[model samples]
Target: MPSTLHETLIEMFRERPALAAEVLTGPFGVSVPTFDQALASSSDLSAVMSTEYRADAVITFLSQGEPVHAVIVEVQLGPIEKKRRSWPAYVANLHSRLGCPVQLLIVCPGASIARQCAEPIVVSEPGLSLTALVLGPDAVPVVTDSVTARRNPELTILSALAHARTKRHRAPVLEAFLAGLDIFDQEHAELYADVVLAALPKAARAHLEVLMTTTPHRYQSDFARRYFAQGEARGEARAVLAVLEARGIDISEEARERIADCADIDQLDVWIRRAATVTKADELFA
Candidate 1:
C-alpha cells in the first residue's frame, strides 16, 4: 500500500505535469524543450513482458502535436536497492515507448536519500551509465513571495515541504501556501495542506495551526472553507494533546491513538475541556 506521503507527492506531480520540466530546468539546469502542454502518460512501462514495471508518474511534454520530451517522476522516501535496478529499466522503457528523449527525476525529501539516488547506475554496455536527476531538500527553493507561490502553487507546496524546518522561511512560505490554495480545487487544496503540514517540524506546525485559527477571515472561498475545515480538525486534535501535556499527564500510546482518531468536533470539544482538569490522560475519554 502506498503511504499518504507517497500518494500526495505523485498526485501533485500529476496535477501539475509541467512541474517536472520546471524543476529540471530551474534547479538542475537541465535543458527541456518548450512545450505547449504537458499530459499524463501511462506509467506502466511493461511491453508484453511477464514482469510489470510501473513508475510513480510519467509526464510527456507536447509541442503542437509532437512529443518533445517525457519525464519519469519517482518519489523515493528511502534508498531501495530494487529501485536502483529497475530505474534504468524505467528510463529505457519510457524512451522506447514515447519515441522521444526521456529523463528520470527522483524526488527525495531527505538529503542523504537524494545523494543516494544521484549515484550513477552503470549498465552492462561499456561506458554507458544512467545518472538520475534528483530534487531533494537542497534542490527545492524556498518560495516565500506570494506572487511566486500564486504563479506556481504546485512548486510552492514542494518548496514548503522542503523548507518547512527553516524558521526564517516558514512564515512567507506558509503565507504563500495559504494564498495559493484558492487556485486549486477543494480536494487538491486539502491534500496539499496535508502534505505541507505533515512535512513541517513541531514549531512550524504549531505556527501554522495558530495562523489557521487566528485568521479564519482570510479563507472565505468555498475551497478555502474545505481546506480550513481540515486545518480546524488538526487544531482540535492538538488541543486535546496540549491540555494533557500542560497538566503533566503521561499520554499512553492508546490514549494518543484515541485522541488522533477522534474527528468529531463536538466530541473533541468535550474531551478538550476534560483534558484540562483530568488527573489521568486516559480519563479524558471517560
Candidate 2:
C-alpha cells in the first residue's frame, strides 16, 4: 500500500488532470499536443504476461474524441530499484493501450531523490532507453500572488508543499495557499490544508495555524460565503435523501447520483422542500 503522502500527491493530479499538462508545459517547458480535454484513464497497465502491472495514475489527452497524448504520473519519495524496470513497462503498456505517444512524469519531494529518479532507464533492447521527466522541489515555483494561485489552485498547493519551509517564502506561500483553498469544497479544503501543514516545518506550521484561526477577513470574503453555501447544499442533499428513505421512497441509482452530484444551493433547497411531501422519490425532480 502506498503511504499517505504518496496518495495525497496523486489525488491532486487525479482531481485535476489538466494540472499534469500544465506542469509539463508550464515550468518543465515540455511541448504537449493540443487537446480539447484531459481525462483520467485506467491506471492498470497489466499485460497478458504472467505479472500484473499498474501505474499510479494515467492522464489521456483527447481532441474531439481522439487520443492525442498520454502521461503516466508516478510519485517517488525514495529510491526503489524495481521502479527503474517497471517504469519502462508502464510506458510501453499504456502506449500500446492508448495507441498514442506516452510520457512518464515523476514527482519527487527531495532534490536528491529527483536526481535518482531522473537517471535514464536502459532497456535490454538495443538503442531503447527511457528518460523520465522529473518534477522536484526545485522545479515547483513558489507562488505568492493570489491571482496566480487562484488561476491554478492545485499548482499553488503543490508550490506550498515544496517551498513552505523557506523562512522568506513561507508567509506568502501559506497566504496564497489559503486563498487558493477557497475554491475547493469543505472536505478538500480541510484535507489539503492538513497536507500542507504536515509538509511544513514545526515553526511554519505554528505560524499557519495562527493565520488559519486569526484571519477574520478570510472567513468574511465571498469565497467563504460560497464555501459555506456548498456545505449547506451537501447537508440539504443528505436531508432530502434521508426524508425520502424514512418515507419508504425507493430512490433509483440515477436519482441518488443526481442528489449527490448536485452543487446548486437553490436546486437543493427545492429538492429538500419537495422531498417532504412527495409520494415518489422522482417527484423531487418534478
Candidate 3:
C-alpha cells in the first residue's frame, strides 16, 4: 500500500504542475524554457501489447499549445531496483508521445536513497545512459522565514518533509509550515499537517505540539483538533509515568502497560495526581 506521505507528495505536484518546473529550475538549476502553462500529462506510458507502466506523475510544459518539455516525477522513499529499471522506459515513452525532450525527476526524502536514484541507468544502446535529477534532503532548502514560506507554501511543505530531522531547523521550519497552512483549504490543510507531523522526529513533533497549544491561531483547521487531542493524551501518559518514577514507586509491567495504553484525558489526569502520592504504582488505578 502506498503510504500517506507518498500520496501527499504526489498530490502536491498534481495540484500544481508548475511545482515540478520550480523544483527543476530552483534547486537543480536546470534551464527549463518559459511555458505559457503546465498541465498534468498522462502518466500511463504503456505501449500496445506491453504491460502497464504507470509513473507517479507526468507534467508537460506547453508554449502556445505546443509541448516544449515534459517531466516525469517519481517519489521514491526507498531504493527499488525495479523502479530504477522502468525509469528509462518512462522517459522514452513520454518523449516519444509528446515529441519533446523529457527529464526524470526523482524525489527522495532520504539522502541515501537519493544517492542511489542519482546513479545513471545504462540502456542497450551503446553509450546511452539516463541520469535522474534527484531532489533529496540536501537539495531541499530549509525555508525558515515565514515570509518566504507564505510566498512559496509548496516548497515549505517539501522542506518540512526533507529537513524534519534537523534540530536547528525544526522550529522555524514548523512555524513557516503552519503559517502556510492557511493558504490551503480545510481538506488539504489537514492532509498537509498530517504529512508534516508524521515526517518530523519525536522531539520536533513534541515541539510542534507545544506550538499548537501556545499559538492556536496558527493551527485552526480540523486536523489541529485531532492532533491536539492525541498529543495531550500522550503528554498526560508521559507525565503519569514520570511522576511514578520520580516518587520511587516500583511500577509493575501491567501497571505501566495500563498507563501507556490510556488515551482518555480525564482518566490520565486522575492517574497523574495519584502517581505523585500513591504508595504503590498499581494504586493509581484504584
Candidate 4:
C-alpha cells in the first residue's frame, strides 16, 4: 500500500513521531541520541517556534532544552518539486524561528542526494549537511523497540525485507513470499517462520492455515521454529534467559513452562522477561 519511499517514511514516522528524532541522530547518521534514549527529547512537541512554511512533509527535529538544532528531515517521495524554489527561505526562516542550530537531511525511499552548501546563505545559512536514506528489500528495517516492528504494516515491511535476504532469488513479491512460506519445507522452514512472524499483523494472522495446520508435525515444526529461532524452545530456555538477564530480569522453572505453552506472542513476551536473566551458559541455550 505504501508504494513510495516518502510515503512509507512519513507513515512510519507518524506511527512513532518520536522515532524521527531517533533516526535522525542514529547510525542513519546525522548526529542523534542512542537508540536506547531515542525519544527522551527536551523539546516541547506542542511548541511552534517558526511559522516559516516552505514545503509539505519536510519535518524538523528539536532537542528538548538543548540550543543546538536536532535535525532537518525532508521526505522526498517523487521527483523534485517547485518547492525547491523555497528551500533557501525555509532554512533561514527556521533558524530565526527556532533558536537551535539545524542540520539538513534528505530522506528518500530509494536513493538520497545532498548539497554541501546552499547558494542563498541568507535563507539556508551555513553548515547544513545533506544526507539520504534508500530503504529497499535488501535493507534491514531499522529496529529499536519491539513495537517498532511488531506493529502491523511495519511487520509486513520487515517480513518482506527478511525474506528478500534469505532467498537467493530476487526480492520476492509480498504475496509470492507468503505462498512460498506456506509450503513449510524443512531447510528453509525456520527462516520462513521468521518471515511469518515478521509478516503477522500485530492484530494476528488470519491466514495461518499452512502455519497453523496443527497436525502433530506442523505443530512441532511451528513450535520448533518459535523455540529455536526465537530462543523460546527447550533448546533456547537458557539463552532466552541470558538476553533478559542483561536487563536485570530473572527466570524460573515455572516461567519456562509458561513460555513453552504460550502460542500467542504477547503472552510469550511475559515469560521472555522472566527467563532473560536467570540462565547460566550461553552455550546451553545456544
Candidate 5:
C-alpha cells in the first residue's frame, strides 16, 4: 500500500507530466525526444503473457500525435527486494505497449535506499540485467530562488521535501516552497504546504511558521489566510508530537490519535510543553 508521501510524490509528477521529462533531460542527463505534448498513459502494463502489473505512473511524450518517449515514475520509500524483479518487467511491458523507449525513474528520498534501488537487477536469464534511474537527495537541486521555484513549482516541492531536514538548506527550501505556493490556488497550495510541513523537523518547522506569519498582508494568498485561520490548531497539534518525536519518545496509536484529533491551540500548547520532558508520549496528557 502507498503511503501519503508516496502518493503525493507520484501526484506531483502526474500533475505536470512535463516535469518528469525535465527531470530526466535536465538532471538525469538522459536523452528524451523533444515532444509537443505530454500526457498520462495507462499504467496498466498487464499483457496476456503475464499477470496484472500496474506502475505508479506512466507519462507518454508525443510529437505530432505519435509517441516519442515514455517514462515510468516510481516513488520508493524503502528497499523492496521484490521491486528489483518487478521493475524490470514493468519497463519491458511498458516498452512493448508504447513501442517507444521507456525510462524507469525511481524517486527515493533516502540516499541509502536510492543506492539500493540503483543496483542492477538480473532477470531469470543469466545475462540480462536492468538498473533503475534514481532521483535521490543528492540528485535533487536546492531550490532556494523564488524565481526558479515559481517557474517550476512542482519541482520545487520535490526539492523542498528532499532537503527539508538538511541544516543548511532547511530555511531557504521552506522559503522557496512558500513562494512556489503562489502559482497554485488555495486548495492546491494548502495541500502542498501541509505535505512540506509534515516533512520538517521542530526547528525547521518553526522557521517555516515564522516565514509564513511574517509575509506581508497584501502578499498573502487565500491559502495563507486559511493556514493561519484554520491550520494553526492542527499545526500545533503536530508540533506537540513533533517535539516528542525529536526526543525519540515512543507513542501509542491511541495517544497519537488523541493529539491528531485535537483542535484547541491552548491545550496543544500545554501538551507541547509537557512533550519536551516526557519520557513517553502518553505523559503529554498526564
Candidate 6:
C-alpha cells in the first residue's frame, strides 16, 4: 500500500499543502519554504531505512540544499499507542547511526479516543522525540473542484469512504487496501493509502484494471475471476502473454499450465497486468 501512495504525497505536500491538511483554504494550506528551495529531492530513503530501522516512504525535508530532517512518517490506521515503542526507537536509531536530525511523525486516519498522543512521543532515551499529525474522520476534505477532481481521480474513493456504509461500496478503498489481508504492513498500508487516494481521484486510475475487480490482489486465486469475467479490457490475456514474451521472461510449461489451470477470473486479470511487466514468467506460477 505504501507503494501506491506515499512518495507521490510529498508532491501533494509541496504543490498543495492544503490537501495534505484538512482545511480547504486555511493555515494548513500554506506552502512551506522547504519545497520552494529544494534544488531537487527524492524518496530514495532506502539508505535511511536500514540506518534507522524504519519505513521507506519517508518525505524528506530539505533546506538550503542540505538535508535537515528525515521524517519517519508512520500512518497508523490501528492503535497509535500500540506503535509508540517501535516508532520512537526507529527515530532514535536513525539519529544515532546517520547523525541526522530524524523525526517521527505519526498520522492516524482520524481522531479517536484511542489516539492518546498528546505530546511529542519520546522513546528509548529522552533525546528522541516524534511529532504526531492525527486527522479526524472528516479531516482531509474531499475534492470540490473540476480540475482537482480530474487531476486526482483517486479522491472520489476517499470521499466515498466518508459516506460508505456497506463493504460493497468501498471498492475504491478496498482496491488499494492490501493491508486488510496483512499482505503488506497494515499501518504502513493505511498511511500509504491515505496520501495517494487523497492526492488523486479514482477516475484517474480507471486505466488500471486492478481497481475494477471485486477480488483483492491479496486473494491470489480470486484475481482473474473478479477482474476478467466482467472486465471490458481488450486482448487482456494475449497482452499478458505478449508482454511476458517480449520482456524475455522465462516461462516454463508447468507455469503456463498453472496459469491455464487457474479458474479465478480475478487472479487471471491481475496476472495479465503483471505479465505486462514481468522479467520472468515463472513469477506467475503458484
lDDT of 6 by residue, 53-104 (tens): 4443354445555555555545555545556655656656555654656544
TM, every model = 0.75, 0.74, 0.76, 0.37, 0.76, 0.41
* Tens-digit lDDT track of model 3 for 1-286: 8889999999999999999999998999999988999999888998778878899999999999999999999999965799988999898888889899999999889889999998899886789999999988999988887788778889988888777678878878877777777677767987888787887779888877677666446543344555567678989999999998988889899988889888899999999888878999878888
Q: In angstroms, give how far residue 106 of model 6 lies from its true place.
A: 3.4
- Relative to the true structure, how large is the alpha-carbon lDDT of every model? 0.83, 0.85, 0.86, 0.42, 0.84, 0.45
Write the residue-wise lDDT of candidate 5 on 134-216 in tens digits.
89887888898889988988878888878878788887787787888888877778788887777667887777777777657
Single out the weakest 10-residue window by summed lDDT for candidate 2.
215-224
Query: Which is the leading candidate under lDDT?
Result: 3
C-alpha RMSD values across all candidates: 7.4, 8.1, 7.9, 15.7, 9.1, 12.4
lDDT of 2 by residue, 1-286 (tens): 7877788889989998988999999879999999999998899998886468888899999999999999999999887598898999999988888899999999887778888888899896789999999888888988998888889898898888788888889888888887888878777876777777787789899877666655364523334455556666788889889989998999999999999889888899889889889999888888
Candidate 4 stretches greater than 4 Å from native: 1-8, 33-53, 58-68, 81-83, 112-286
3 or 4, greater by lDDT: 3
Return the TM-score for candidate 2, rounded to 2 decimals. 0.74
Model 6 scores what on Cα lDDT? 0.45
Estimate the overall C-alpha local distance difference test score of candidate 5: 0.84
lDDT of 4 by residue, 112-150 (tens): 222312222332337643223333333334332323333
Residue 15 C-alpha lDDT in model 4 = 42
